[model samples]
Target chain A: MGKLKVLSVGALSTIQDEGRFGYRQFGIPQSGAMDISAMQNANHLVSNNPEWPVIETAIQGMKLEAIDETIISVTGAVVTLKINEHQVPMNASHQLQQGDILTISKPMGGVYFYLGIGGQLRANKDFGSYSTYIMAGFGGMEGRALKKGDILETQGGKPFKKHVIKQGTKPSMTETIRIMKGPEWKLLKDLPERTIFQVDPSSNRMGIRLIGDPLGIDGKEILSSAVIPGTIQLPPNGIPIVLMNDCQTTGGYPRIGKVVNEDMGRLSQLNPMHKLRLKIIPLEEALEKR
Target chain B: MNILKEKELPLLQFNKVSWDLFRLGEQSLLLQAPFDIPIEKIHDSAKLIKSVLGSLLTDIVPSYNSIALFHSFEESTIIEKLSTARGISQKKSTPIQKVEIPICYELGLDLEHVAEHSGISQDEVIDIHLNDTYRAILIGFTPGFIYMDGLDERLACPRKANPRKYLEFGSIGIGGEQTGIYSLASPGGWNIIGRTPLHLFDYKKQPPMSVEVGSEVSYVRITKQEFESWGS
Candidate 1:
């Protein structure tokens, strides 16, 4: 019954969980947390289940006033954390007394950050998930982004005292992400021997629009087919679009590459205008790394 | 085999990704399918390949014309299964169930617009629309929103220049040679001619989806009174 009421929702905030899976055949996009690893780490820090619901914020952080005493942790995008005006570490769990105000600022490095509570966040669930799907107008706080003065409830349970902080290596923000050739790769005539497309400003959860030389292609319309979260589709415009968690279940655009499952986390955290180099890797090598 | 030879079904080839498996992230693999074909045939092929791969492998997603196989195994057994499955000949098509949906032309908000644009009477528009059975070519754009083909060519109409702010759930609309029903309220450019009471998507249902790939859908025209009486 414990909860954390929102005093002021920061610049960008949304409720997210692991994701809703196995329903793509129905055309529902898998809307979930953008940074899967960060969400997991944040949950681990609070000893909550790895897939428990958490709040994801963009560059600017959120401010919350605790309704009840509880333990929480922040992870991803290196944001400055404070509890009642006292500075706190981003990756460690801390107890907040009721009425204590927590403020977080924009990230020093990354574009996204996560706040993990010890228990589940109170939000309406749709299709067995609490993640927001703004396009469908369902889930989360009225199926849209969190605004200021929104109250968030959580099932406050006893916090685990023994926090196992498994520090993992953070991916370099500047690293070029590799992608395997897409199904329609052969259709492209003048593809760079080494492909690296920069992310465009128009990118969001729906998909990442890339800025690159038009990939020359054999004239043909690819049949509409199933698209996964990491699919890289090339529309007739010739610019490749990398689909994300909120992407459609199927599409007709030509696919030139698919980001390996392991690299999607990295791509999810990429800011606008970030450059990503696409190196072709063997499926075996990619799987081995996983 | 004799039927295949007589039908002249094109032989589909399976080619493996020559370069490294493109990594989308830590948990997914994108297996490429050959491109270049009619949209319907590509969809058919993707559905066929999806069924084959779904039956042969575990924990893989067959996305639009591509297969995204997921695995937690350290040994890459999933890759082996995919490669082996890809090497085989095309599998037989599985039978898909047919769903009959009832639509009330009176409930269509843009029926007059459709009639006026096509230079036909409202009655003529309805007549042309109800004359043919539509096939579900694919399911996309939104959950349970089926992409149907086989609209009467005479009734073909382009999508609206500007998308409507909100299309009522169950609204049936035509865009070009395709006509589909909206499973949920969404912004759309399609010319909505009518609406149905049937629920195409329900979260509590066992399968969750009312229609599936390859399902044949036929529309039954009902009167506004009949729709209201049926509690549509």
Candidate 2:
């Protein structure tokens, strides 16, 4: 088995697989890698299953040392990568020998980036997932984000027979997120023809707080009901907040729209202060794209 | 006995996603029925839909009144199968199973407090709670946690001002008009009343969850001594 020693922990870093599904009934939110495309791309570079666990870093990257020789790939958000102070290109595979130090600088754009090792990242699994839920303090490394001086073990499985690296193809960085009208959209007061705005800097994996016109609906308390990942909730203050992987199982706010599943990934990658347009697409078209 | 009601039930649109499509992520979509329908109608519809679409779907999760059909986002055909199934309206003839749970008064840590808040006697609280049979409204939150409705209005309680640090497994609690059994020890705000000895969740089991949405749950009171024995 091989291992990686964390020398400098970034702002936010955690190990995540695809995510824990089929457990929402218990009030548990789905916590997984923020960017599915980046995670999948890293896995594809190493020819591992796309759902394999990988290290997800926020805007600021971290520094790590490979204890044993291993193959690794970095994907998601343009970031500077270096092996032993030697610059390495992003979105490509690299062979690191024993004692090789790897450093990922702050991302040039996008909020999160993924680092995937060829083999499984050794981490405890609870409730059928490696993702971390900071609020509940369960899953991933001791159920929390990685910290400085932490040592992570790797399964050190065999390397891929062929390394396939796909050159950089920037996804449309437009802040516009497409959503379908929610069940409670009618309950909103002073409903606007359009309420989408650019995502704010405070956004993280937990949720995206949109900077848009308030719905201006005032009402009494609502009955608690089920809330899915993409449900856009308008709190009493009227600002719409889109729930994500780490959202609560149930809420009592009126929702106006649910981001079609296809656009969630793009929404997840938006950097702070990035302007996003909200487009209303028919539910049938959204499902057709799926 | 009359099975159908005389009053006309409001017609609701049932939405279903088309098959042979992968819309958002790797998740296929199947809209089983409308939201906010009567509990009995939703339960019966979900049961019928599950039996009809059981073979095609794998993870079928029912909520307040809607059923979400999930499958690998990679499978394009799952969408088509779900939409096709949604177009058909068929009622299942299979009998629904009901499970009785044994609850101990000794574990009813908040029962006295709840009674005080509701201006009812402890004995009255117990009587009202056990008098009415409840229906499992949904199975969500954690794996195997059962949310049942039909609690006596007298016993309906709100969640704690702040969620408790940890709730014991199998702990029966009430929040607002809903009653539920906790399958795992996790943070909760529900007012705890008692506990059941039966395990609600076991990953090793085939179904993994013991109770399904739409099942009937009855609370059978047991003495403290019997609870102690059962605990052992």
lDDT of 2 by residue, A1-290 (tens): 45778999865898888888766655567888877878888877766778888888887889999888777888888889999989988777787888999999988877788888877777878678888877656678888899988877777566645565664455455556777766555566754445546677788776889787777775734455556678788888887888888877666687666888777777887777676676766655766765
Best by TM-score: 1
lDDT (10s digit) by residue, model 1, range B7-102: 111223443233234333345545544443334444454454455556443233344345554445432444554455554435554566788989
TM-score of each: 0.84, 0.79
Candidate 2: docking tier: incorrect
Tell me the TM-score of model 1.
Answer: 0.84
Residue A250, model 2: lDDT of: 64
The Cα error of candidate 2 at residue B101, in Å, is: 2.7
